[model samples]
Target: MTILSYADSALSLLPPVVAIMMAIVTRRVLLSLGMGILLGAVLINDFSVIASGQYLGEQVAGLFWDDGAVNAWNMYLLGFLVLLGMITSLITVSGAASAFADWARNYIKCKRDAKLLTMFLGCVIFIDDYFNSLVVGSVARPLTDRYYVSRSKLAYILDSTAAPICVISPVSSWGAYIIALIGGILTAHGFTDSGHLSVFIQMIPMNFYAIFALLLLLCVIFWDLNVGPMRQHELNAQKGNLYDEAKGLPPGANSDLPEAKNGKILGLFLPIIVLVLATFYFMVSSGGDVLAADGKPFSILGAFEHTDVASSLFFGALVGFIATLALVLIQGLDKLYLTKGLVAGARSMLPAIYILLFAWTIAGVIGQLETGKYMASLASGNIPFALLPAVLFVLAGLTAFSTGTSWGTFGIMLPIAADMAMGTHTNMMLPMLAAVLAGAVFGDHCSPISDTTILSSTGANCHHIDHVITQLPYALIVAGISLGGYIVLGFTESLMAGLATCSILFVISILVLKFKSTQAIS
Candidate 1:
């Protein structure tokens, strides 16, 4: 049974706002989320503590073993995390990591080459954000470290490319989820003969945030566009200090792994290559007839449309773990050493698992309070249709930023944007839809409490808050540009004109960064 709803009042915003503030202040996502959950419980009991303690107990316990948001899929994700930890630990101990670093030294001669290769690898792994963020960061960090690239910058590249690429790629898990969401909405609203694939494809042109974000990453890479806290991090990195003095080496750094004396690069490459290929295969196969509404055979796009990301990724990781172990055994390493590496790898992912639980708990509490519904109703009052796209963009961004979940933001905003535009007899359907997508991603990019942010930090071995601070400036630049684009599209109703604004602003920003860097150097 759904509880904690407050009939679209200001109170629905309290839990998330408190959570966001507490996260930034304490820099402890778990504690902040717990406080938010307690606050939600109190609010549900009409701001009384008579039974709030008991209710909070149930809610917290429910996060682990409940049949709600933190159910089977959550377990699959947890399993994937542990499995991934094992793989990384294996690579570290198996000597593959050092070997790859040596191999990368020849090809990646300078900072630019290292950063660009990181970017290239990130873009290439568009299957899923979790996969992309983890794989790219792990593979590139050792290479990047040699050139004095900051962990914060590496995290930014990982985070930026992960969600943005997945959001835009039609064959990706993100796209599949979006397509399914859009498909359901389309069916409910009486639209026929049009598949979500075509709609997603058409929506691409107006996905200004995702497009410009990738472009912004290029500017940062090619032009060394360091701004805000990122610049200090970069400078400190050049001096061989990758983190702020206050935050020392993380407790679970991979330094615990016993380095092999004769590790081969292929030991690392073979397992990752297997995971990537197997994930794609399982994704297509897992969807089966779920992609077809009428019991028909699954087409290529149809398979992607119905793919189960958690299942496929878990399968890929399991296979990858086994492959990595086998490779280690064949390398003539002590069996005990291999066993230790696997256990250590799995153990290393515990922090991420705890964070994921808290994230899901808050998401659950937000759902119970109907927070997204309350947020959406803010746009329900009479408004000018011409400015709807811009309004929706800001509102959608706020929702995603508060919730720290882009998919949740999409579910709430997309339907409202669609119905609102159709009801008002406006021609902004495509733009409004695109705005929902753009704002969700932009907000997710900026949100410190976001899963992708946590995963990015985990991947790059950077302090979580460091990653959040360093990346925020870049996310805001794209957001500001996206908001302007939406406003222009609102007025002109021309996608080309609006998109042109994004391109122009990005180029100008790159030029400004270049000038800034040149001046600083001299």
Candidate 2:
């Protein structure tokens, strides 16, 4: 039951590695995650069965009530998920989703248009990755469904866009956190000429993974680059099989309920609009208080830096739920039907919530084991200055992949990356830091236990394994391209050269995919 550091040894990597391998082989996400948690608890407890059991129990309990009080952030996020499910269900049952689809059908003539719209929404909702993941999917689902775009593809679009866009946007939650982290790193290194905001802006161009991931997504969409398992999923969709029903229904979908025929488009848009506005309002409001408490002047950046995202999302979802319920009631739907919507909504979210809880518990166990620290340790004692950016990118990606957290990787690797660059390769400091961001996101994109990835599947209403399996090829391809870019930048120390390399590689990749598709058709 006592926590111990395994950062000095290779033991820290076992749990995540076991979990990831099992998830891939068995395709039972919860069971795989549970096994990993069990293994991690045993390791932390030094192989004591009784102690491990107690530690596991405590970790589970601590998720809801930690440090003598309710865990506001975790509880609020769960609340938001439940409320979102209810809202989605209510909107559908009231026939709004159908009406929206019917209206959208008139304008969206082809599958390509449907996918383009999905990708566009994914980019536009850049306030937060979690918000972007869930909201974009809900808005785009009906249209994509009508045009037979696979849920796996929808999930891909959501996952790819969410974190990449957030990391690069200064006003986003991810950007705010990264900027603050960079500020502390700069201060520690005694660099005062440039501030965090300016540094982040400068690094944006150097963030190869984020930039290329987005561009690759566009290529996949524009060229219908259905590679690997994605090709099968897309093919199935063309035949009216949106997902493998045998894998089980998606956690966010409610198929048993009959929707009303008189649904209006207003039913869908009203709640979603309110949700976005309310969440943004609460994010700034909550962030403002923290800024004031810190004796800092109010600014958008300050607000985002101090915002309570979990609470803001919960309150916004609550308001959105009320709007959805009101709209349903105004339609004069039967009370019993309304009750069904509530139950169905809550029931549908249970699987996703369970996966989230398991993922969180395992992440905590990995944290206690100091897995990230161990990974960071490996990045030390590097050789050449020119290769530092590439090395850091790979290390950061490994850390995030193992820990199932991009933010945790950023926290651990950013300071070290900064110190390494400042001490040895001063001119490459920005590139080093940018490489960390890029790698963290790349790892997060591939990690099975990443919350954003889980939520992307939930939002797109795809089987979790299906989403993971189908998206892997695309993620790995982008990661490879990113790694190459970092190496070019590291050797040349020129951002333009690295970007040009990425651009050329990306174009070639698109053409190759196009040729492959043609071959497959022939």
Candidate 3:
């Protein structure tokens, strides 16, 4: 088969799985992604070489410099990584993180409560997943640690809430991406009468994966139902078997550190509030549009035309840094100490920043090789109409898992799913799209190289590997339930029925958990 034919044939399943296995075994995410991209590019190039009698190097160069490659590199992933570094750097330098940590430590006394609060905060800040991951992890890790909540658990909660919440919320960066993808599919299918924003609003409820994941996260928090690997980790943690089991030196060690006290805890709150409010103001002012106003009805979309993940984080982080500085100076903090605190915070985030860059580069390479599109095309031919939602969910999951990015997965899946829905004459668009978001989140939640996963580990002061191991079970359970829900909804086309079934299952699960807890207590 030709390269395009093979890529259109089987690159998705084989290459991504190969990449993931390589990453896990080598423990080098970037290397694995690089290999995956190389394999994909080689497959395409070799096929062309065999068919056209061209040199492999020439074909590879042409493919790499294609418009698609340039767009993938310059537009989506590169800018996103730079913005991630800047925002994360600002968060650390401002001493806003320390302030938030101290305040949460003083107020939240229980491990479960701390986890729940983190989840709630994640829901509230649905504008950007990168912002959500960095802010929530930075602020909540300290509080969660004091209560003996495992670092793994904290990472899980943070990962669970970040992308899943934002993708469903109309005000977030994920929302805008979905709308754009959906608009393209809609226009292609002669559904231009329905505005992109309007269609997104209508689809929110049908997104089974996002809805179920949030609900399940709440269950884990309030109900304390730790099944599968999460349960084992929790048991081991309680038994003092977790990594670095020894209780470190006194808690005051951190407190007494000059850098820790550089800024009052309240200082962190101010910048976060400003960033959040600014995001909301812009989102609403633009009518969830990505463009600036120009007297056109859709002028709002123009405002966000230049808005990428990096741009949003840049503005928010800048405001946060200024707020942190002003608050520290006003409180008569020593200038040296303040600078030291900021430096400390930045140092703390270094690991996460490295992980983010690697994750982005990997995703970029996958796009360059067209791995995801190949996978999507392969599945399109064989998918049964009744199984469309499940197929989409799985495809989205694999894409995010391989790429270590939920946003990229959604960008790849939404348009294809929408087009499939129209072609099949099935009303499965909303549910399928929801599955895309949910599946992407599930994979990103567990993938060790994921930015949110790294941030969750950083926030919780947990080892990154520990977080990935413990968080996997919880993510899978939610995915299992979401798959079932999507299947039901796909057949019935009844959103209400699907929700009811999920609710009943959730309630039963809670009851079972409570009974099991009572038995253990007895």
lDDT of each: 0.84, 0.91, 0.64
By the TM-score metric, which is better: model 1 or model 3?
1
Going through the candidates in order, what is the number of backbone clashes in each? 1, 0, 12
The lDDT of model 2 is 0.91
Q: In candidate 3, what are the lDDT values of residues 30-111, reduced to their tens digit?
A: 5765566556555555545354334334344443355546534333333333333333334444455556666676677677
Instruction: Tell me the TM-score of model 3.
Output: 0.79
lDDT of 2 by residue, 1-522 (tens): 467779897999999999999999999999999999999999999999999999999999999999999999999999999999999888888889999999998998888898889888888889999999999988999899999999999999999989999999999899999999999889888887787798899999999888888888888888788989999999999999998988878889888787898899999999999999999999999999999998999999989999999999999999899889888888998887799999999888899999999999999999999999998988778468888888888999899889999999999999999888877878888999999999999899889999999999999999998898999898888888888898899899999999999888888888888999989988
Q: Could you estimate the TM-score for every candidate?
A: 0.95, 0.99, 0.79
How many angstroms is residue 78 displaced in model 1 relative to the true structure, after the best TM-score fit?
Answer: 0.7
**lDDT, candidate 1, 1-522, per-residue tens:** 225566478898898899888877887767888888888888887766867766667766775577545655777877888888888888888889889989988888889999999999999999989899888877887788888899999999999999999988888888988888888877777777776789889999899999999989987898788988899999999999876656654312465578787899999899999989988888898787575555878776778877788888899999988898889889988777787887778777777777777877777777878887887888888788878998898888888887888999998999999899789754677689889999989888887668888888888878777788789989998898888888888888999989988778877777887888888888
Candidate 3 error regions (>4 Å): 1-6, 9-15, 25-109, 232-263, 278-290, 293-306, 508-522
Report model 2's TM-score to 2 decimal places: 0.99
Candidate closest to the true structure, highest lDDT: 2
Superposed on all Cα atoms, the candidates' RMSDs to the truth, in angstroms, are 2.2, 1.0, 5.6
